[model samples]
Target: MTATAAPPTSAPVGALSSRRLLSAIFALLGVVMAVWGSRMPAVQAAAHLGPGQLAVVLLAAAAGMVAGLQMGGRLAHRYGPARLLAGPTIIFGLSLALLGMCRTLTSLCLVAVVFGIGHGLLDVGANSAAVNLERACRRRIMSSLHCAYSLGALAGAGLAALTAWAPYHVLFATVGILTAMAAAAGLPLIQSAAHLDTPAQPDPTQHDDTPQLQPRTVWLLGFLAAACLLGEGAAADWSAVHLHTLHASEATAALAYAAYSAAMVAGRLFGDRLNARFGPTAVARAGAALAATGLGAGLLIGSATAALFGWMALGLGLSTAVPSLISAAGRGGPRAVNAVAATGYLGLLLGPAAIGALASLTTLPAALALPVLLAAVVALSAHRALDSK
Candidate 1:
């Protein structure tokens, strides 16, 4: 029998450059999120608003994100990922800087809406480009790219603490300028490094879902992504509240989210190796189960330490789920990836609000059960939902 020839080795330049660009984009996005998130207390004080009013303003931003996601997808489909990437990067930085400059509640709300629009567009563009890059590389690198996001988030959050004494607008504007510069520099490197071919010379891996592009498959992927992100949104919004409700000190309660963010970073850093070995289906199923179990335990124990541990577990459990789902969605092209990303963003937009609504009817701890249930649903369906066969 003739010996099987080895598959030709892929070039490293485009793949390497794409990975760098994706990492920078993810990190910058994380920085923008942390810069704004870390200043929420300051914003509330500046605007002189209560929790309910703040929620309303935040909802405006979420709505903008949803609209942006829809439009960004269509735009990416029509214009290509490169333009979407370059344009949105600058807009995202500018909008984020504008957030700190808002003096009135109305101004804050409107700026938030615009920021959300930029954020949503940037997210879709980056993830869509990532999918294309992964196809070019023929490897599992999404987890590592997400790890960059986690690292940037951690840095931003930490920096917020150091700059807590600085003027809010000044702090935000400084970060925004840095982000804009990075975007200008990093995006061109990505273009130079990318191995894009014309439609006539499409990569085989890139064409896997082109023929099918089934609406049902896309919807199922979106549902799975939403389930994962809902848990993430809840953890981000309510972990501290849950700790405070359980009677932890103010300082201790604040550490709850830090634990989650840290665990997510660690999980993602190692997730690429895991995904490569076990495949996305296994990684997702196991992760969802862990998230459900961890969050449930935290709620059940009702202790500060347990809460921290739970958040950590929850972060680890959810970290790989999104990357796996997005990678799968990417095969279907930009529109498909955007649809999945949009659905996931909807979960982020609505999950916290749903928890708050339920908190009014029941209790905060009880409301958290919603995410746990969603995670369990993901665990049960992940294999089928992510199946490429």
Candidate 2:
């Protein structure tokens, strides 16, 4: 049932095959969802909803994501990564199309929940597959796999900006098309529906025992993951809004997120090299510092252009932390994947929801400062928390 029990086979050494293909496909799906979600402001405006109503709709998506992530790892463990990968992708594509059709607030909330489930499952399954493929390839391929996700996000943001003047339904339709293409692209990589069992490795200490993650380590990794996800979530949900507050046009405000996405993509592409040279602790520490500084500058300067640049710096700074943390969590063995994913997702789930709640209570500007301060705390603890291999 566990990954370590699988028999070793010579598939190909670091070759581009099923896993890489699937990662790319899911990465594109991730991009589409991110773009569609990022354009929520437009969606809300079109529906004539106030901030409170919009927050409710957003919470539905967040709740679904948390639920799906918690369950996805177990599903992957039971059925294998390929089935887990394909099923959710189809659902994601369908939900995206459905998202375009919803008219009422209730319909929108319903579709958002479905979309969140699909997105969450796809996230956990694809990343699980990527880790497996990397193990088979015997190389550091996780960062590159995540880089694909970042690229997809960048493309989605660009597509959204380009078609902002068009009907929102058209944008959703385009995203659905992209999602379908990604799903189709992944079909060749999936092996079968039946679970394949392999023998567990011999252990002198405990021949009959199964591997499991220590509870304490799982909690620690979860906390670290939450910090990283919260930082990224803050940027994703708020950077453009911050730019708009500084008097940027709608198109230009979107560009603030585009800048962040671009920098993030760039960072992920080179992340492995940096990780090799500096280690996860150093990278995380530096990233935290940069994210905090960028956020601070964005808030203090009060210029649209400067705020955009600051967001870009924040993106570049925060890029490697999540992927690195995921990799570290897996170090304890395959059993750690779910706990790690679930815990990390808890942060992802909370980050935006908390921010929205704060924005409701106080000003959006003041609420934005929360993640900046959190990032600073992460930076200060990076040396101790993230350094564990």
Whose TM-score is greatest here?
1
Candidate 2 residue runs with Cα over 4 Å from true position? 1-14, 38-42, 45-50, 192-212, 246-252, 297-306, 332-335, 356-366, 387-389
RMSD of each: 3.7, 4.0
Model 2, C-alpha of 200: deviation from truth (Å): 11
> How many steric clashes between backbone atoms does each model show?
1, 0
Q: How high a TM-score does candidate 2 get?
A: 0.83
TM-score of 1: 0.92
Clashing pairs in 1: 14-193
In the range 1-389, model 1's lDDT, one tens digit per residue, is 01123343574555676677778889989988988988899988988889877887898888888888888887766666666676677877887788888877899899888888888888888887777666666677889988998899899989999999998889889898788787887666756654432112354454323533467888888998888888888878899999999899999989888889989998999998999899888988998899999989988998888888988988999999999888878766777888899888778778888999999999998999999899899999888768852
Model 1 worst lDDT run, 10 consecutive residues: 194-203
Error of 1 at 142 (Å): 0.7
TM-score of each: 0.92, 0.83
lDDT of 1: 0.81
